[model samples]
Target: MSRGYNGTEYFRNAPGLLSVRLKTRLMWDGRLDGADLPTAVRDMVTEAHFMNADGRLIQERIRQIPELLALWREAFGAQSQPYGPQIFVAIAEFLKTLDGGDTWWTAPCAATR
Candidate 1:
């Protein structure tokens, strides 16, 4: 019911992700927890309508790339192997920094201007 990756579907445009850290609910219908971004990322990535990605497959793929493996090892210690939850958590942390003052609800006057 929303936009997706790789030209997968275009039934409805997805909402922009900027300023999600300020939201109290997530997704078009607010079905996800805005405060729990890692869970949101996990849901979106695994959902067929969204990224349609398998975490195990993604982990395997990343494991094959030496540079990515090295980076992961550096960040997560040498024994880590691109675990799914860890990856989602890292992505959520990065997303937390994506504030562009873009949400109209957070700045109604800016939207009217």
Candidate 2:
């Protein structure tokens, strides 16, 4: 349901973030290293067919958000800035918490009883 800013539809459907921690490879083509989540996030953000965002611009805009800045300072250190890499790392950390463990999808089928 999403398209790039340039109006191009992605060739492959975006996969769900669920259980990403258990994946050994990411993306439909498995081009990215799943063990390196930060890199995957950076690629998605910078890719022309994806976010198409400039890292410098993203950091500059983030610097203006007081709440986000406060969070960055608290998370990284009092002197930390909202640099692009840290942004990707933070996003990757958040994505790691999206695991679907114990959800109904993991439960045995009741009809099998």
Candidate 3:
């Protein structure tokens, strides 16, 4: 069932990640309730056609970075450091900052006035 990277309509605009938080479901089929960003990030990383990476593997790799480990500790106060779920949380938080610049498409048009 893996779609395998086709480089065709595979990626969405990064800024759209912010808007997805308002969605009731995640993924194209809209099966995931609440569209939870952490859950979506975890699924994307582990899904075969996407990152295809094990959560444990990602955690191990991230732990090797001293700066990131420190930031994780400061952010979450985790004594053990770099908990697997923290990675997803961090990614979700970062995506929240991707609010796209205000453009005509995002502005209120005269029709609404």
Candidate of highest TM-score: 2
Which is the winner by TM-score between candidate 1 and candidate 3? 1
Task: Point out where model 2 deviates above 4 Å.
Answer: 103-108, 111-113
37-111: candidate 2 lDDT, tens digit per residue: 999998888988998897787898888989878888888999887899889889999999997886665557876
Order of quality (TM-score): 2, 1, 3
lDDT, candidate 1, 21-64, per-residue tens: 98999876787878899998887789777888978977887899
Worst 10 residues of 3 by lDDT: 7-16
Best by lDDT: 2
Global lDDT scores for all candidate models:
0.83, 0.84, 0.71
Once superposed on the true structure, which residue ranges of model 1 sit more than 4 Å away at CA?
1-11, 101-113
lDDT of 3 at 106: 61
| Sequence-dependent TM-score of model 1 | 0.76
Worst 10 residues of 1 by lDDT: 102-111
Query: Residue by residue across 1-113, what tens digits does model 3's lDDT show?
Result: 33444443444432246555557777777767754788888887887656778779988887888887887788878786676787898888776667765566666786754
Looking at model 2, the pairs that clash are none
> Candidate 3: lDDT of 90?
86
Q: 1 or 2, which is superior by TM-score?
A: 2
Model 3 CA deviation exceeding 4 Å by range: 1-15, 101-113
